[model samples]
Structure formats: C-alpha cells, structure tokens
Target: MRAIIIDDEPHCISSLKYDINLFCPEVEVIDACHNGHEGISSIKKNDPDLVFLDIEMPAMNGLQMLDQLGGNIPFQLVFTTAYDKFAAQAFRLSAVDYLLKPIDTHDLMDAVSRVKLRLNRDVSRQFDNLKYNFGRPFAEQRVAFPHRDGYDFVNVKDIAYCRADGAYTTVTMADGKSTLLSKSLGEVTEMLPVKLFERIHHSTLVNIQFITQFIKRDGGYVVMGDGVKLAVSRSKKDRILSLLGLERW
Candidate 1:
C-alpha cells in the first residue's frame, strides 16, 4: 500500500515512518511533508493509498487542508494527534481511524491494516463528520454508523438499544426506527460511547437514557421508552444495575 506521512513535527514524522518500515513493511512511504500545503501537493502528486495526518499544524491545520482538497479525497486517512480529550472523541464520532502521539507499534500496524482494508471505500463522509464535530461539544456530536451498504449517520442519543442479530447488530432508535449494522454487537459496542450505553445481556445493548424501568420478571428485563422489553443476563445483572444506579433489593 502506498502511503504518506503529514506532520509538522519532524521527530513524529521520523518515528512514524520508522515504525511503518519496521512493523508494517507492506505500506511504502511514498512521501513525507512538514505542513498542510506540502501534504496537499504530495497527495495531488502521489495519489497515495493511505495518509497518516496530524491534526494541528501552523497556518493551515489538517482540517483546513482537507477543506482545501474540495472533498475530492480518494485516499484513506488515519489521523495522528497528541492525546487531547476532545480531539480523540471527535475522531471516534467521525468513525475514522486515529493513532495517539508517542505512537505505539501495535496501533500503527493496526491503523495501516485498516487503511489497506478500506483503501477504496468511500471516506468523504468520515472526513465531513470529523470536520463537523471538531468544533462542537460532545453532546452535539453525531456518529456515522458503517454497515455493508454504506454509512448511517445519526445522533448517539437517538439510539434506544441494539440487539444481536447473528454476526450483525440491529440498532433500534428511540422513535421506533431501526438500522442494521454489518458489525457484531461487540463491535457495535466499541463504536458507541461507553458512558451512555450499557450491555445488559450478551444479546442486548441499551442506551441508558431511554431505559424506562427494570423488570425483575421473565429472567429480568428492562423496559425501553418504546415499550420494548430487553432481557438482562444473569452474569451482567449486578454490574449493569450498579452502572444504572438501581438497587436489586
């Protein structure tokens, strides 16, 4: 896979390139740039398969650089940034891959793998999501749920619950709408923010805000806002109850 590294810090660029060379040898470092302008020119010239982009830079930040690209992006982007709480959250909501600075070999290799896997897939929406949410608060941030056909963008708060459907998951919105995800329940859980969602059963994931009441009968279930009863597993009972701040007694 042809790749490019774009970061203002020379050391960061060097370390990332070295790790890519050592661990992920399949990805060729086609070019490296010190700022967004050079990065844009390199992208136009190389048309690389993957780009490792740093968020902050002088004059033109990464987002601004992307805006300058006019949304005609063909390369997969994996953002690399120093750990800022909000910036990390924006990446997650954007459903784009990212590596925290002082990069780990494992994460670097994994990011490379993702880029190669999704090289030809559409990423315009992912870029849009990041750009849109970067300036917003966590509550206002929306997530782009990726399924087989494409992505379904929605507010995390609107998701009522998710049920395991074989290898895929079915996300039921609070308004009785549903979207099928091409990921397993476990995988879908990873996509959601943990603070607002909880696994009450091996087959069920619920948005804490939409849970109306807990029923002890029928192997224990929770009533959702839409009157759906989702079972709670025996093993996860105490922990989920504790998380919900509900007393079993």
Candidate 2:
C-alpha cells in the first residue's frame, strides 16, 4: 500500500519511515511531510492509500487538518499520538486506528494488517464518530467493538459486565447478549472508564450502574441488572462497598 507519513518532528518522521521500510515492506512510503501544511500538499500530490497522521502539532493539529480536508477523505487513516488514555478511548470507539508514541513493532504491523483489510471502505462514519466523541462527555460516549468485517458501536451504559476468558473478554450487555472481544481483560479494562467500571474480581469487571444487590453470604457476589451474579474478590470488596456507598451487612 502507498502511504504518507505526516508529523511535526523530523526524527519521528525519519524513525517511522525507517521502521516501515524495515518491517512493512508492502507499505511503501511515497511522501513524508513535516507539518499539516506540507501534509496537505503531500496528500494531494501523493494520494496515498494510507496516511500515518500525528495528532498534536503546532499551527495545525491533525484533527484541525482533517477538519479542513472536508468529510470525504478517500484514504485510510492511522493516528499517532503520545499515549493518552482518553484520546485512545475515543479512537477505539470510532474504530479508528491509533499508535501511541514510541510505536511498537507488533502494534505497527497489526495496524497495517487491519488497515489493509479495511481498505476501499468508506471511513466517513468512523471519522465523524471520532470527531463527535472528542467533544462529548465520557459517560455519554459510546464504545465500538471490532468484528471480523467492521465494528459494532454500542452505548457504554449498555454494557453490564466483562468476563475474562484467557486472552479474550466476553462483554455482556444489560440485555443478556454477549460479544467476545479479541482484546484481553486488562486491555479491555483500559478502554473503559474507571469511574463506571470496577474490577470486582480477577476475571470480571462490572459496571457500577448494573449492580442490583451485593450478597455478603458465602464468598461474596454482586447481582447484576440482568440477574447475573458475579463473584467479588476479597481484595476489592472494600472498594466496591465504598463505590456503592453501602454499610457492611
């Protein structure tokens, strides 16, 4: 795939280009731009299949640049940012690819693979979702789950609990339906806001809003809104009690 690398830092552009050349032989770097201005012209001239865009830049940030480009962007985009959890959450909910600072080799390759698979698809919706989310409150923001073909966007409030199954997580909605996410439980935990989700057990994360009752008898478990009961770890019991504002029963 023909690609463009856009960043404000020269060394970043150089390092990313070198990495791409070394690891992703299939992704040719057609153009490397210093800032948003150069990036605009480079994009027009190169018309790359994929664009690696840095989010924060002086004069014109990536989001501002993208805003000026209008809504009908024709190429697949991968955002590069300095490890910010909130920003990454927005990207995930939008199904937009993002790489944190000091990008990992495995991560870059995975992003490339996902981009290749999603090529030729219209990404206007995803972009719009991402932009909209940046301005919205965390509680109101929706979560997007990646599937085999695309993503399933669901309201964050819809999730009742997340159950870990080895490397994957089973996200159960309040309605009792569950979707197995490719991400591990720890990874999944990062995607969720800690204000709403509590790690009740080593293998389970429960949405605080879904708790119906906390049974203290016989090892301790919380009954969810969906009538599902999940165990609470002894270490986390006090925290859960504090979160629920409950007196020990």
Winning candidate number (lDDT): 2
TM-score of each: 0.89, 0.84
Over all chains combined, what TM-score does candidate 1 have?
0.89
Error of 2 at 34 (Å): 2.6
- lDDT by residue for model 1 (128-235), tens: 988888867666678888867677779878888999999999999978999888889998887777788889888899998898888887788889999998888898
The candidate scoring highest on TM-score is 1
Cα distance off (Å), candidate 1, residue 243: 5.3
Residue 116 shift from truth in candidate 2, angstroms = 2.9
Which pairs of residues collide in model 1? none
Clashes of 1: 0
Give the per-residue lDDT of model 2 (tens digit) for 1-249.
Answer: 999999998898988999999999999999988889998888888888999999899999988888878876899999999957766788887878999989888899999999998899878778877887875777788877777776787888789999999999999998889999998999888888788899999999999999999999878999999888899989989899989999755
